[model samples]
Target: MKETVPLSVTESSEAEALFHFETGAPEAVRAALGLNATRIGDVVAVSMRNDPTRYWSKALGFGRTAAVTGELIAEVCAFYRAEGTPLAVLQLVASVLPEDWAEIRAREGITAGSSWVKLVAEVDEVVARAGAPDRRPMDGLRVAPVEPGDAGRWASVMMRAFGMPEEHYSGMAAATVTQPDWYPQAAWLGEELVGSATVYRFGETAQLFGAAVLPEARNRGGQTGLLVARARTAGELGCRLLVSETGAETDGGHNSSLHNMLRLGFRVAYERQNWVWQPAG
Candidate 1:
């Protein structure tokens, strides 16, 4: 592991911006279609206009101290409730202060969720690691960007890989392919789809997410291939920074993706806390 340093102010701000751009992209698409997405400070609150997934209907805070005022949090939560969101999630960048956490805990119907570490790497470095001269592509595995017709298969593989419901991932895949600059890629082995990944570009930064691999393909190099393919594509698009997040290092061996990312030169830049609100009986 590389030596770690505390997050500087500029690094914190940039990471927060990437977080908002990445988490807010889908909601931003929904908002462009007249859904309820409003900005308060560096926070963006998106409601369940179409998809009712908690991931789709929540408030996203960017930067250090993204949500400083209790009033901002209350208003955003109220907006989601008014829009019929059963559960509201507040995902804040590592810069959030203790007072903000205290105010959030005081809110009715809210509970703390998982904390995640945001990882970042220079696109050049990832590209180099991915394109090492001795690194040969895994035999019997092929990866490529999804065509428009691959949406159904892509959705099926994603749902199965993540154990998500068909209804949820199907609709998500349908809507996602139509978003601007959303690149969904899939990996296959002898015509069987085994894994999937996605990259969303914001300015010079490319945020990677939604990487899923089937259980049968776990021991193989499918996951690493998918990561390298996505990173290369992002670099080809002129992005300089590659940002991603994974569950923090808590359970000893549960965060293999974090290990994979570190091997690809990604460093833990900061952490984010998740606060969730579900209506009481």
Candidate 2:
């Protein structure tokens, strides 16, 4: 555990990271996907008209700048409703989840959803972790910066790794390759592009997002290699901290991503809930 980071810092780092990625699509792609976003109080919520998945259509980092009040939640729901986005995920830092969250969620037709374990690491600690023999498999793995022309290929490999439909999110993911302060990388196992990772730098923090490896490329040190790649990139850019999150481990279930992150010196800052909301009947 690196000295604990303030929840407000985690909140801002994460909120800006995801917001920039989700709404960073090109003009035509934005129109094609109906990508849009708005702020409710200090909370930023985004919606995708074409993609039905709630992951990209979510309100995050709320209640950190202010109290988690029912009115605030109502405004959040209204934003989604007006956009006609059928479902939404609301993420509030567990440490800041209002005391009456249960009642608020119940009244708003929100239900419990998966929790995410937020993690952070100092750049130096991660560089040390990456030097571990176990983390640096001797397989023919190499991580390199994604070229301008390779954005599509980079995004394709990442989405494929997660079994996501490429048509919905790949274009936007690729767009990040050119976004300022965004560093995207692809992992190559010999001649084939096997995985992808990215570091989104904001202020003094670098956010780790979109890291994944294909099924055929698993357990070969590609991910750890990618982590090292991004960590170094962030450090070179003068970032002091790296932030990331993955699904929390639950009873009878496990999240390999979470395990991998923990092994790389990323400590759990907190567990944040995903509150699901749908229109009332």
- Top candidate, metric lDDT: 2
- Which residue pairs in candidate 2 collide? none
Candidate 1, which segments miss by more than 4 Å at Cα?
A: 1-36, 49-55, 63-67, 98-100, 133-139
Error of 1 at 62 (Å): 3.5
Per-residue C-alpha lDDT of model 2 across residues 80-125, encoded as one tens digit per residue:
8888777888988766777888888888889988888889989888
- List, residue by residue over 1-281, the lDDT tens digit for candidate 1: 64343333323333343344334445444444234556666676765545534565657654444435666667767777677667767776555544656756676567789888878888789889887877656767888998878877887787778776665445455456556767778999888888888887766777786788989887577777888988898889998878787888775557889888888889887777788876656
TM-score for each model? 0.81, 0.94
TM-score, model 1 to reference: 0.81
What total of clashing residue pairs does each candidate reach?
A: 2, 0
